[model samples]
Target: MDTQTLIYIFVGGTFALYIGIALWSRAASTKEFYVAGGGVHPVVNGMATAADWMSAASFISMAGLIAFSGYDASVYLMGWTGGYVLLALLLAPYLRKFGQFTVPDFIGTRYYSKTARVVAVICLIFISFTYIAGQMRGVGIVFSRFLDVDITLGVIIGMGIVFIYAVLGGMKGITYTQVAQYCVLIFAYMVPAFFLSFMITGTPIPQIGLGSQVNDGSGMFVLQRLDAVLTDLGFQAYTSGSKSMIDVFCITLALMVGTAGLPHVIVRFFTVPKASDARKSAGWALVFIALLYTTAPAVGAFAMLNFVDDVNETQYSEVDDWFTKWEGYGLTAFQDKNGDGVMQYRPGDAFEGAPDYSGETGPSGERALANTPNPESENEVYVDKDIMVLANPEIANLPPWVIALMAAGGLAAALSTAAGLLLVISSSVSHDLLKSTFAPGISPKQELLAARLAATAAIIVAGYLGIYPPGWVAQVVAFAFGLAAASLFPAIFMGIFSKSMNKEGAIAGMVSGLVFTFVYIAYFKLVAPAANSADNWLLGISPEGIGVIGMVINFAIAIAVSRFTASPPVEIRRLVDSIRVPRGAGDAQGH
Candidate 1:
C-alpha cells in the first residue's frame, strides 16, 4: 500500500481505539471522572503515566532540539528526567497520601484556606494552557504534513478527537487510552531508530550505532564526523556547548523542579489506590520512559547526519519531494540567494524572519520568498527545528510504513498529553474553583456537568493557541516548565516539608515567583526580540533559565514571611507530620 493509505489505516485505527475506550470506560460519577475511582493497578497506571508524561515535546521536539542545538540541548534530557526523579521520590507518594483529586485540592485543605485553593487553580491553569499549546501545535504539524490538511483545520480535527474522549470518559477513559498510546508511541519511536542505526552504522541498536564508526570508508565516529561537517559550514561543533555554564545549570534546575510541580502529572498519582502504589507506578513509569529518552540522543545525531548529507549544496531542482511538501506548509524553504541553483545550508538566518512565501515559484522552481534575505549570511534554507524528527524517516529513505507509523506516534504523543492537561484544567475549574470555593453547595451531578463544560471550553482555547503558537513546540513547553517551577513547585514543596508554611506565605511566594518569571520571559521573547541575546540578559541568564532565580526568590520570601506570620494551626501541623510518616512505621512505633 501507499504511504498515505498506511497513514490513514494507522491513524484512523488508533483514533477508533481511543474513542472506543472512552465509550467503554465512560465515568458515571464524580469520583470516576476525577480519579478513575482510585483503584488503578500500579503497572497499568505506570504505563498511563509514561504516556501522559511523554508529550509531543518529548516524542517530537526533544530529538529535534537535540539535532539543531547539539550539546546545549542536553539540558532538556537531564532536566526533564531529573525532574521526574524528584517527582517520584519526593512528591508523588506524599501527594497520594494526601488523597486529593488535584493539586489545588491538596493546597486548599493543607493550608486551611479557600484563597490558597484559588491561587493554586490560577497557577495550574496558566501552566496547563501554556503546556497544551505545544501539544496542539504538534497535532497540527503532523496533520499538515501527513494528512495534507491546512494547519488550522488540523488543529480543529485534533480538538474534536480530544473532546470526544476527554469529555465523555474523563480520567477513567484517558487512563486506559494512554496505556495504549504508550505502546504505540514507543514502538513507533524505536522502529525508525533501529532502521536508521543499521543503515548508517550496521548496528540495529541506536545507542550502539551512535558510538560506532560510519558504514562508509571513513573511520570517524558519528560525533566526530558531525563536528567536522557542522564546523565546515561555519556552525558550532556538535560535541561542544555554546551556552554559558550558569545558563545551562539554571535551565536544568528549572525543568527539574517544574516537572515536580506540574498539576497534570501530579494528578496521575491520585488515580492509584494508595501511596505505596504511587511509588511503584512511578518506578514503572521511569522504566517505560527510559526506553524513549535513552534513544533520543542517538536519533537526533543520526537525523542530523542524514539531513546534512542529503541536502547541503544539492541542486534545487533535484531536491527530494519531502522538502517541497514541507515547504508548501510554510515550514521549510529555500532561496536562490547567490542566483545559483545549488542550495547552501549554512550558519545564520536565511531570511529576516520565517519565510514569507510570495505564492509563486522562482526560476529554479523553488518556492519564492517575500521576506528579505539576510545579506550578511550565505544560507539559503530555513528549517523549523520541530520538523527534524517527523522528517527524519523520509530524509533517510526509510520504508513508507515506517513513515506512517511515525505520523501515528506523533499524534499519540500529542493527544495523550493534551487530554491530561485538559482534564487538569477541567478539574481545577469544577472541583477547586466551583465546588470547593464559589459553589460549595453544588451536587455531584452539577459538578460533573461543570467539569465537562470546562473541558469543552479549554479545548477551544487550546485549539486557538495551537493554530497560532508563540514559539516552537519545545520552546513553548520550556516556558510552561519555567512558569510551573517559579509558581507551584515552591508552594507544594514547602507545604509538605515545612510545618510553619502558612497560607499567606504560600500565596505571596507563588504570586512573586510567577510574576517575576512571566515578566522576564515576556520582555525578552515578546517586547524585545532583538535584545534576546546573552549580552542583554540578566546575569547572562536567558529567559529560558530565569525560572531558577524566580524559584529561589519564592523559597526565600516564603520562609521569611512565614517567620513573621502566625504558624499553622495545631491540626494542620499534625496533618503534615502524619503525611510524612510511612504507613507501616506508625503501627510499628505504636507497638
Candidate 2:
C-alpha cells in the first residue's frame, strides 16, 4: 500500500478506537464527567496522566527543539519530568485526600472564599488556553504534512474528534481513550529511535546507543562526533552548553513548578480512588513518561547527524529526495547566496534572511537578494525545527510504515493532551463559573449540559488558535508553563502548606504573579518584540525564565499579606491536619 493509505488506516483506526471507548464509557453523572467517578485504578490513571502531560510539545515538537538547540533542550527534559516528582511528593496525595472536582474546588473550600475560586478559575482558563493553542498548532502541522491537508483544515478535524470524545465521555471517556493513545504514541516514538540507533551504533537500546561509538569507521562516540560536526560547520558544539547556567536553572524550575500547578494534570490525581493510589499513580506516570523522554535525545542526536552528513555538505543539485519533498511542504527552504549551488548550512550571519524575488542583478550576474527582507538568519537552507520528529524516519531512510506510524504518534500526543485541556476548560466554565457561582440552583443534568456546551465552545476557540497560532507551537507552550508556574503554582502550594493563608492573601498573590508575568512576556513577545535576550532582561532572566521570578514574587506577597490577616478558623486548621496524613482518607465525595 502507498504511504498515505497506510497513514489513513493507522490514524483512522486510532480515531475509531477512541470514539468507540467514548461511546462505551459515556459519562452518566457529573462525578464521572469531572473525575471519572473517582474509581480509576492507580496504574491506569498513571498511563492516562502520561498521555495528558506529554502533549504535542513533548512528542512532536520537543525532539525537534532538541535537534537544533542541543544541550539547551535539556532544560525541558529536566523541568517537565522533575515537576512530576514535586507533584507526587509535595501535592498529589494531600489534594487527592481533599477530594475535589477541580483545582478551584480545592482552592475555594480551603480558603473559605468564592473570591479565591474565581481567581483560580480565571488563572486556570488562561493557562489552559495558552497551553491548548500549542496542541492545536501541533495537530495542524502533523495533518498538513502527513495527511496532505491545509493546516487550518487539520486543526478543525482534530477539534471535531476531540469534541466528540471529550464532550461525550468527559473525564471517563478521555482516561480510557488516553490509555490507547499512550500505547500508539510511545510505540511510534520508540520504533524509529531503536531502528536509527541500531543502524548507526549497532545497539537496540537508544540510551546506550547515544553514548556508544558510531558504526562508522570513526572510533569517536555519537555525541562526540556530533559536537565535532557542529563545530566544524560553524555552529556551537552539540554537547557543549551555550546558555548561562542561571537561565537553565530558572527555566527548569519554572517548568517543574508549572507542571505541578497545571489544572489538567492536577485533576487526574482526583480520578484515582485514594490518596495512596494518587502517590502510586504519580510514580507510574513518571515511568511511562521516562520511556519517551530518554529516547528523545537519541532521536534528536541521530536526526541532527543525518542532516549534517546527508544534507549540509552536499551540493543543492545533489541534495536527497526528502529535501525537495519537505520543500514542497514549506518545511525546508534554500537560497543560493554566493552564486554557488552548494548550499551553506553554517552560521547565518553573513547574508539576507529571506529569498529575494526581485530581478535586480548583482555584480556577479546573480540575483541581488535584499538583506532587509529576512532577519531570522542568513543560512541558505533553513529547516524548520518543528519538522524534526515527524521527519526523522525519512531522514534515516526508514520504512514507509515507520513514517506513517510517526504521523499517528504525533496525532496521538496532540489529541490526547487537547482532550485533557479542553476538559479542564469545560469543567472550569460549567462547574466553577456557571453552576457553582453564577447559578447555584442548576440541576445535575443542567450542569452536565453546560459542561458539554462549554467544551464545544472551547473546541472552537482552540481550533481557531491552532490555525492562527501566536508563535512556534513549542515556544508558545513554554510560555504557558511560565504563566502556570507564576500564577497558579504559588497559590496552590500555599493553599496546601499554609493553613494561615487567607482568601485576601491568595487573591493578592495570584493577581500579582499573573499580572507581572503576563506583562513581562507581553512586552517582549508582542509589544516591543525582539530577541529579548539575556542582556535586555531583568536580572538576566529571559521571558522563558521570568516565571521563576514571578513565582518568588507570588510567595513573598502571599506570605506578607497572610501575616497581617486573620488566621484560618479552628475548623479549617483541623481539615489541614487531617490532610497531612494518608491513613484516614476516604473516598472523595463525588460532584
Candidate 3:
C-alpha cells in the first residue's frame, strides 16, 4: 500500500481501538473513573503504567537525543528506567495500600493540612502541564511529517482525539488505550532498528549490533568506528562521556528520582487490586518499559551511524533526496555556505553562499578552501532531535508501511501520555482543590462533573502551549522531571518513610524545594543577560541537574523542622503503618 493509505489505515485502526475500549470500559462511577474500580490485574496495570510513564519523550525523542549527544546522554536511559526500580521497591506497594485516588490526597490526609494539599496540587498541575505541553508538541511534529499537515492543525487533531477518550473514560479509559499504545509504539520503534542493525552489522538484535564489528573492513566495533568518525568530524566520541562529570551524575540522579516521584505514574499503582499486586504490577511495568529502554541504545547507535553514512562525504549536489524532501516538510535544511558545488560539512560561519576558493592561504595557513573554517563555530547544522525518530524508518530505507506505522506509533505515544497527565490534573483539581478545600459538601456526581471540567480546561491550556512550545520538547519535558524530583519526590518519600515528619516540615520542605528549583531553572534557561545569569548558576550546575540539590534541601528542612515541631498525630501514624502491610483492602478515602 502507499504510505498515505497505510497511515490512514493504521491511524484509523488505532482510533477505532481506543474508542472501542472507551465504550466497553466506560466508567460508571467516581471510583471507576478515578481508579478503574481498583481491580485492574497487576500485569495489565503494569503495562498500562509503563505506557503512561514512557510518554512521547521516551518513544519519539529519547533515542534521538542519545544518538546525537553520544554517551553523555546515557543519563536519560538510566535515569528514566532506573526510577521504576525505586518506585517498585520504595513507593508503589505502600501508596497502593494507602488507597488514595491522587497524590494530593495522601499529602492532605497524612499531613492533616489543607494548605499542604493545595500546594501539592499546585506543584502537580505545574509539572503535569509542562510535561504534557511537550507531548502535544511531539504529536504535532509527528503528524505534520507523516500526514502532511500543518503542526498547529496536527495539535488540534491530537487534542480532539484525546478529548474524546480522556474526557469520557478518565483513568478507566486511559488504561487500556495506553496498553495498546505501548504495543504499537514499541513495535514501530523496534522494527526499523532491527532492520538497520541487520543491514549494518549482519545482526538482527540492535543491542548486539551496537557492539558487533562493522563491515567497513575495519576490525573495530560499530561504537569504536562511530567514535572515531565523530571525532574526525569535530564531534565528541560516540561511546564516551562529554558533559561534566558532576552534571552527568546529578542529572541522572534527578531523572531517576523524578520518575519515581511523578504523581501521574504513581497513581497508576492505586488502580490495581492488592498492595502485593501493586508490587507485582510495578515489576511488570518495568518489564514493559524495558522493551523500549533496552532497545534505545541500539536505536541511537544505529541512527547515528545511518545519519553519518547518509550525509558524510557526499557532495552538496549529491545530497540524498530525503534532504530536499524533508525540507518541504520544514525539517531538513541545506544552505550552501560557499559557491563551490561541493558542500563542506566542516565548522564554518561563512554561510551566506558559496565562498570563493582562493589560491592564497587563509588563517589556517593552508590552501583557501571553499568554506571559511571557523574552528569554534557552533552552528554547523541545526536538525532538531525530534526529527530523528520519525526520520529513522525512512533514513534506513524501510518500507512505506513501516514509516506509516511509525507515524501512528508516535501519535499513540503522545496521546496516551496526554490522557494520563490530563487524568492526574483533573483528579487533583476536582478531588483535592474542590472537594477537599472549596466544596467540601459537594455530591459525588457534582465532583465527577468538576473533574471533567478541569480535564477539559487542562486540555485547552495544553493545546495552546503545544502550539507555542517554549523550547526543545524533550528538554522541556526533562525540566518537568527535575521539578518533580525537587518538589514532590522528597515530600512524598519523607511522608511515607519518616515516622516523625510533621505537617510543618513537609510543607516547608515542599515550598523551599519548589522555589529553589524554579529559580534555578528560570535563571539558567530563561534569563537573557547571559553573562550575569551564567555567573549566578551554582557551581555551573545546570537547572536540569540542580534537582539533586533541591531534594537534599527538602530532606534537611523536613528532618530539621520535624525535630523542632510536634510529630504527626497518632491517627496519621496508624495510617502510615497500615499502608506498609499487604492484607489491607479497605478504602482510605480520596481527597
- TM for every model, in the order presented, reads 0.96, 0.94, 0.92
Error of 1 at 420 (Å): 0.2
lDDT of each: 0.89, 0.85, 0.80
Candidate 2 per-residue lDDT over residues 1-591, each given as its tens digit: 988899999989988999999999999999999999999999999999999988988897678778888898889899988998898889999999998899998888888888889999988998899888878877887888889898889999999899889999999999999999999999999999999999999999999999999999899999999999989887888887877888889989998998889999999999999888999999999999999998999989999998878877578898877788777765676777666888778766334432221111222221112333234554677676767788888888889999999999999999999999999999999999888788999999999999999999999999988877543333344568778898788888887788888877888888898889988887766555455567888887778888999898998898899899988888887788788844534545331
- What global local distance difference test value does model 3 have? 0.80
Q: What does candidate 1's lDDT look like per residue over 265-353, in tens digits?
A: 99999999999999999999999999999999999999999988888999989999889988887678888898889999998768765
Measured by TM-score, how close is model 3 to the native structure?
Answer: 0.92
Ranking by TM-score: 1, 2, 3
Better of 1 and 3 by TM-score: 1
How large an RMSD does model 1 have?
3.7
- Across 1-591, the per-residue lDDT of candidate 3 in tens digits comes to 687899989988998898888878887778887999999999899889988988888887788878877787788888888888998999888888888899999899889999899999999998999889878877877787778788899999999889888888888989988888888888888888888889889999988888899877788898898888888887667877756777778888998888888998999988998788999998898889888899888888888888777866567577766565666654455544444555444433332222211111222221112233343443333344557778888888789888888888888889989999999999999989989898999999999998889999999999988887654333345467777888889888987887778899999999898888877776655553243232465776667788988888888888888889998999988787776644524454321
Clashing pairs in 3: 337-353, 338-354, 338-355, 339-354, 339-355
Candidates in descending lDDT order: 1, 2, 3
Better of 1 and 2 by lDDT: 1
Evaluated at residue 582, the lDDT of candidate 3 is 40
